[model samples]
Target: MQTSQQIVGQFRRKRLFIAAMVAVLVLVLTLSFRFFEEKSRIEQQSRDFANHTIARFDRMFSPLDVSANNTQALVGLRCGEVRFPLIENLASLQTVRAILLVDHGNIYCSSIYGERAISFSEAYPELAISSQRMLLTTDNYLLKGSPVLMLWTPKTLDNHSGLIQVINIELMSNYLLEPTLPWVERAVFNVGGKSLEYGNPLIEEALPSADEVSYEESSLRYPFSITLFGPPPARLALMTLPSQLPLALLLSMLTSYIVWLATANRMSMAWQISYGLTAKEFMVYCQPIINASSGNCDGIELLLRWHNARQGWIPPDVFIPLAERQNLIAPLTRFVITEMVAHLPVMPRCKSFHVAINVAASHFRDRAILDDLQTLWWPANPVPQLVVELTERDALPVVDQRVISHLHKVGVQLAIDDFGTGHSSLSYLKTLQPDVLKIDKMFTAAIGTDAINATVTDMVISLAQRLNISLVAEGVETEEQANYLRERGVDRLQGYFYARPMPLGDFPAWMDRHLAHIAA
Candidate 1:
């Protein structure tokens, strides 16, 4: 049974780890895709601009050689002044920048409103030539638009009169791509094995021709320069990537936090199953607090618990705090004590022995608890002299004394459960002064290995002795701890090394088992 529990616990840990890893992995995958997608989108935008610009320009310059058998009116004002209304018509398209008709050169009868006509020298070398349905800039947006198609047309007039129209839309920076963040100093997307630089190095490196191209992320290192491939024939079209990586990093942080919260909630539920403690459910598992130094027959501690039957055992660590926050601690403690005392006489040796119990300080503050105890004591002749163990954590000094005084007045003994673990144990000692000090499990954890701990133990024992108090060592998991505590004059001890908590019905069987061990 123990092995099975250990296996289940291991599985839970592994599963949580895997889930956390998967969450991180999924985020990484998304980041990888985003990085490349940004690059592709930029490239696609460049191509779209090139294509759109070139298409409209194509119809304007090549208008079927002035029609066949046309009248003087149709060709009115001759070649340079031909009625190429179609050229001006395409300009209405929002995406179209402008249209220019270069008949017999010399910026001959142009209709380009937006694009201020510049000499061939001012525009890149052959950027003015429109040839064979293709557009070529003498110098690429050398910094921006990727060169789409470059072609040449033979001139029919002025020897150099062939139309040369270069197509170029807005730059990627001014158009499509949005920076991932304000702090992203650099973003270099390598998709299709072709590098794209935004807000950094200008010019995308074209890919080696491949049938199918897909980009796989190799590494994503930080804190580096994102300079575009520098120094072009014609400069001025380069800008750095928007410095905004905080947005992406913030997203990662949020993802991690969400995962942490979810896992914590799930584990809280799982622990409820294992321990059977929750807000609404009640459970009890009596365990013997054996004095191993003398014999395995000291007494039993009636551990009252809250279990959420549907959700499982709420871990005391989780639900107890919630109960306290909700102000349910007092009622919970009262209910446990009342129920346990009612069932006391039926347990193994309720008439003959002492049974210690834990009570939250919330109950200690309520005077009703004292009255109730008196009523419970009235019925049974001896009225079970319960060793009321008050947890140090919740035992406030102001009320602890009031409660302890009441318990003493009612003839019930008091024990300080988890003695040295509370933040105010030493301070509270002078005021609240509980009867028995149940040593915290942690002090005994390293008893055999440390001398200072032994000295500390001795000092605590001395303090208890001075106060005429008794010491009960808790969590004596090893014989060594029990021996050490016994040697140091600890009056009682409890641990799994002796026995785990059990149901009251199993008391007789446990005693019988101990007897058999004693005999052996």
Candidate 2:
């Protein structure tokens, strides 16, 4: 048996928990997407860098290849002439380390040792007279006791002559090796099964596994590839993490707060309605219902009002529907009855002066309301006149003949409120046979206006007259409207034209003033 407060509290907690979970889910997805996006961007950058470096190498060395071809053609036409000026000019070039001219399996001319003949076959067995194609080699040649890259171009002029262009390995290494991006820990350059490397010494010393290499690209024009190694994917993701963390958190909180704001009203109303009965925020106000013909106040209709310390004022139209939807209407109606009974002593003594209290459809379904009314009315020597007003806005529950019969037996009166506004107004009127018919304010507002609404008002007056039912025209704000209803034999008028709904503390004074005005 959970109380309304407990149930409402539980529901609020559940909804807040769901909102938090949704926010967490959104944050997780955002971070995951950012991680992959950053990874893809870094990988693309690495590829671009590799391609640019390889293109740069081709641009740097293309001139050297052309020069080697020119040198071979010159030596072939000259038949290996020992020209000092020709060898001196070629050797003076910055990029050329040494040049050797070989003829008939023997070294004949040299830029470093002019006319110093050496056996080419004995000095370099790797160079064969039969090989006559241009070839580039990277190997440790003992001639300089260091690694060297040789461009060998063979020619035939009378006898076989070979032009050898020797380039120091250090020059090529400097051209190919440079520091890359911060994330790129190392860069490896491989050619003809031989390898060279540059970049962070720590990373070069302890090479990453093949699986750990982030990006690898090979030269499109040469027999070499560049492989880049960096921190693992996980580490790369972490390096870029802090930059996106704040934005992710902001998005998560913004979404969650919007959700909370959207539902804050409903949850607040639930709390107010749950504790309202005990906190005494719920109070009844009254508006005088005047006899249209006599110009005298006949009775007051009770209207519910809520004044919360925190929320200020909550109108009945807003909270009443909520209460009905939540099944809290029964308790609210009971509280109203109890409050009316407490105010019985202050009510006017005139028998004709009645107090009308609106009842919800839920009240008619059970005998509890009947029992409560009986207990409250039993003690009065002459119980105050009471009117039970049922609105047609909601359909009546299954006819509780027992409750209806008991109400009639106890000298209580019933009236249909807000007539013609509900889906089954006529059906309710025919079945319940209430003592009074209160025309809805929408029709009353149209009085003395257009032909259509005037005709509608006339017809309602005619219907009430024929059925012998007391008629009350509501919302008669203007003199023209009030006069029209009075002339049409409207039994009672209840609206702002007569008086606004007043607090109970002010109702008695207002009633006295109205009575005196009528007497005058």
Candidate 3:
């Protein structure tokens, strides 16, 4: 008996793997949701900020309400001759880097940091009056300390051209984004040749060349943006803020997977042992098919018996399904095929000798399946006469055609195991034209004992003869059943009456005893 540590370790490993898978799923879902939420929040904040800023500019220009501001009025206001509250109020904000007033192809006043007031036309040579709609425009441009936003509004008075106020605002680094950034860490802009002045080098050159900057820590992000005075400048630059949450989440996911994988790997070997299937540890048993003429045993149907390391003598009925579900059927069938092939070189000296192996219908439909078996068969020491047996039920139409055609081409004989039970067998037999028809033991064993079985057996045998299909009786348990099948012209037979499947080593001795008896 295996120790509890050996037994329980395997189970624990499997569960832990399941737990790990669950954790990965959770991590993915969590990140996806957080990403969606963060993206949505950033967009919403941008919308709200744009709406508020634009509304303030719109209110200032509403009072002007005119198509033009005459040069006299503009010059009077700029030269301290007349007081215009709208222009003065906007210019007074210290964050404003410069203010320019333009009217009717001429400049009125230009102030840079409110220190040097000059004429706009004289200061800039390219100062031709632009026909472009330049009423209340807000945008960002790079400057020394930070990005500066310039808002342009054409102040109009009574349908005449008025001065255009260029209100330059130093872009606030932390406006709507301060809540998302760290306490000590500040958001900075990267100026890849676009030239934005921030205190740190990283912020000055973080992004190669993009207009917006967003820095992330874990699932959270802080956004910093720059707007050009005109249409959003196509070229861009970026930068980031310092944070640690992103690193933590990534490390946690990696550590969780590695630990789970290592533990799961160590546990799998024990699990296989606890529920293991070994060819050597299996018993090869046979059921007899009785002969039509002599009424004695004709052949043995080879069945595998697995003795589990934990549970003794696990039945095929219980484990075959498990094997298929676990994708172990291919390996298991290969084992059985190898063992049976070894039987080919050695068989009893019976008048007729053949061994039947039950196969899942899935194999019959697999063309490559027979080819795979051929590869295994050619090298191994040969076995006695072999019958490639398949169940009548699982074979589907398309699979049936491919399997039957392939089987015939390979010169391998096919027999439908447990024949007459499936309603579709008669039709399948007509098309497939297999070499042998196996009578279900129900019909053979129930003769005279079960009235319906006797009639069914006689009809099935007659049908087999009519179709030129060889008939064999399976699951024959008694001398009476053997005699009954022989009377009814059952061609081959197997049951407990014939020697049950002895071990491969024991089989030779059993055959020698029978030969000795026949010789005597």
Candidate 4:
């Protein structure tokens, strides 16, 4: 069978393992969710950038298309008659740098330099066909090195006559095709078989393939489309994942701590008890023991109180029985003794005034209780007497009479507490020959209401008087109960009616008030 200590150790290890597993689970789930979310965000950004660039392309060229269509009638007219009209049209359009007239496969007029004798098919074979509407090329006649978008409108369907509008696409490409990195590394404007990317002075010979494009958007009103290229959405999302690690770790730790706190009750309370002892979380409180006949406070019982750091104010019933069961009562009793010795100044400097503490039967083994008192208590040379109350809940071990005699010789008194609550009360009276018999609270509560128990209370008082032992009535709550016990010759009364248990440091003030009230 596992001992309590072994069980406590195993429980602690298991709780820590569970908390670590929860932390790892939380971290993995958070990072996975963030990765997918970032990927979706990057994908959306790419798509929006491509579509917005397409809309700008249409806006830049739609006016040029309208102006070119209006000038198509001047295609067959002489350059002398149509030159001024073309220049006026060009001046009205902000983007159009030049306009040309093409008739019967010959380029004969220009808005910037009129009366041109250039052959349409040799000079520009792509536009001479009159079938293609747009081309991204650097072959602008006036701006030699700059890229331009050529808008074509044919006068007739004979593959001969048309108007050509050269737009300054290179200048507009700065804002129109700008790439927003790291999602979009490059943005390209494609027309026919040519391509122009941001900040490029000349058109590219070939466009990017399908694999290199991240997102592509085409203009519904024009032939051109904007293509965005960069790392894949998943890769870009991964690159940004490092930035989120600190927050993910923090949240995981917080989640783990919360789980640990939630499961604290299930963890070993024995370990908590041991920890409380070491941390000095236990405190000493004293209930005033009033001399019933004189109504004078003559003694106080030192009670153990625990204030756990995590769980505040643990009741004595919860820990006392457990402490005895786990064999920890001996250490706890020693703690109470040490604390009493430290706070001895609070008690009156009179040997007749006693301070009492309950001690478990197991502490008597090998004279452990005696050694604790000698080591921690005797050195202080306290003015008040020390009383050890042995509850009848446990059978008193067979102790040497010399130990009891020696305790009596040194001013320590033995008392039987909670007298009738246990099975061995009468046997305890014969064996221990205690100096004091404390009538348990149940019998005191039966003072008026219970006839049989009240008879039993009277019998106990009669027994104590015949044995020449002083009697202390426990839980004397009402004045009638106090009067009944006092009239029955009970020597001392301990209950809330006199004074509730308070910190030992407050006892001096409480003693002064009680003495003053009695004197008044």
Order the candidate numbers by TM-score, best to worst: 4, 2, 3, 1
1 versus 4: better TM-score goes to: 4
Using TM-score, give the best candidate's number: 4
Off by over 4 Å in 4: 1-268, 271-281, 325-328, 396-411
Q: Worst 10-residue stretch by lDDT in candidate 2?
A: 198-207
| Pick by lDDT: 3 or 4, better one | 4
Error of 3 at 425 (Å): 1.1
- The TM-scores of all predictions, comma-separated, are 0.45, 0.53, 0.46, 0.55
Q: For residues 1-520, what per-residue lDDT tens digits would candidate 1 score against the true structure?
A: 2233443465467556756676667566556556555555544544444334334334432332221111113221333344355254434333333333333333333334322334533342343442223332223433344532222233443323333333332232223223332222233333222344444333465332332222222322211112212122111111211222345455666675677566664554344433343443676667787764657666788765544554344455555555565566655565656666666666556544677877667766657557656666456454445787777666464754776776777677778777776777787677766778888887788586777776777788888988889788888898888787887778888888788887666776788888788878
Across 344-448, the per-residue lDDT of candidate 2 in tens digits comes to: 777788789888888887777768668767666555554457888887767766667567667778778888888877777667667777788899898998876
Off by over 4 Å in 2: 1-268, 308-312, 377-382
Clashes of 2: 0
Model 4 accuracy (lDDT, Cα): 0.85
lDDT of each: 0.53, 0.72, 0.54, 0.85
Candidates sorted on lDDT, descending: 4, 2, 3, 1
Model 1, runs deviating above 4 Å: 1-280, 305-310, 348-352, 375-383, 395-400
> Tens digits of per-residue lDDT for model 3 on 292-358?
5754445667787777654465566556654554456566677777776666556664435666777
Error of 1 at 247 (Å): 28
Q: What overall lDDT, based on C-alpha atoms, would model 2 receive against the true structure?
A: 0.72
